[model samples]
Target: MGRQRTKPAPTPPTTTRGRRTRDGLILAGREILEQRGWSAFTPEAVAQTAGVSYGTFYTYFESRDDLLHHVVRSVAGEMLAASLVSPDGVDDPYARLVESNRLYLRAWDRASKVLRLVDQGAAADEALRQIVHEIRDFYVGRATKGLRRLQDAGLANPDLDPRLTALALGSMVEQVAHARSAMEEPYDEDTVVDHLSRLWASAIGLQGAPDEGWAARARATAGTASD
Candidate 1:
């Protein structure tokens, strides 16, 4: 007669301390991306920087590239979040655009090292490049929607093409943000905002652009309570 086989007990779930350790490793890798740039990154360095065992690091992530990917994606998400939210809310669309631009400038100031690494890596890595493009595309779509709103409110030129203009403006802002990182002396916050704001204003120039009256009207209508 054959003996009945017994199933082994399931492996125990990971502990809170273990999860915290893994998160610490990821955080360490992110700090390297910010401070040392991707060129100097290594998993061993991350483990040392994190003060975690190498085996522990591997338990959460497969390799250095995996860690890099996670770091880049995280930083990209942070930038996107800042870029998407309007500090002034919906009261003033122009102010909202200006505020969001300033936010991007500030975010890039802190994230420049990571941004540069992603920019460089994207050229050689298809997945990285796609991620970069996806980030930019998100900004472009938002700008396009804003431009469309401006047009609807008679704040932008009705004849102007929103899609092309949005892409061009978004590209200009992103390039300027990246270029700011390369400067030996960082430009003042107001300087960046004024420069970008003016560039956008001129691009849609007042003859065909929204005047103060249009903005006032929009605000007035927008502020009125719904019946």
Candidate 2:
């Protein structure tokens, strides 16, 4: 019978020198993750890139997964923080959508390579998949909160589901973020943001005529008169 051995708890960075070394590892991890993706994103690679020994890698992170988690979290935070779609913000629904989409697009553009790698890497690895799903859930949850505000304020269509609307709209923006450059004629930031925001607004009846509104009423009236 034998006892299993585990790595000791990592020491927290307290001094300036310690913090600089830790920060360097994190930066190297992010660059490696973006450049080479899952298979090549190793703690050894990070430590080497950071100009530290393999033993030093473990002083800050518990495992390769931990380092990747920090890198992904950092990227996601930057992406979300750029958007101003707080439920408490005073911006009108349409304006909020526009600003959020605009900033989100810009941030996503900056990290598109890593995001695209995340998409691909997640498909191949279970751990990476979990990270991707978690990030998406957080983004969708925030979006749903914003939509709830619109619904409560009588700005959104009564019949639309806020959570589902957020998921769909957020997915639309994600697709736009990933595929805009692939289009035959790539659109500028303002045009793309405006169109996507308009679509989001129209989806919840925020900026578009409702299906049961005057337009539908007019069509029904014309049909009845003709009959």
Candidate 1 accuracy as lDDT: 0.74
lDDT tens string, model 2, 1-227?
11222669787899999989988998898888777866788877898899998878888888886677677777777776766456676455566677788878888876776667667768877877887888788888988987888788887877888789889989988888778743534788998987888777777878432332656789999999999
Candidate 1 error regions (>4 Å): 1-19, 87-90, 206-227
Score candidate 2 by TM-score against the native: 0.76
TM-score for each candidate, following the candidate numbering: 0.78, 0.76
Clashes of 2: 0
Best by TM-score: 1
Among the numbered candidates, top lDDT falls to 2
The all-Cα superposition gives candidate 2 an RMSD in Å to the true structure of 5.6
Considering summed lDDT, which 10 consecutive residues are worst modelled in model 1?
A: 1-10
- Candidate 1 per-residue lDDT, tens place, 1-227, comes to 11222334223229988767766777898897777876667777898899976555666676677677777787888888866664447656566667888888888877778778888888888878888888888888888887888888876778888889989988898788877777654777798887787678667642342343566787788889543
Error of 1 at 154 (Å): 1.6
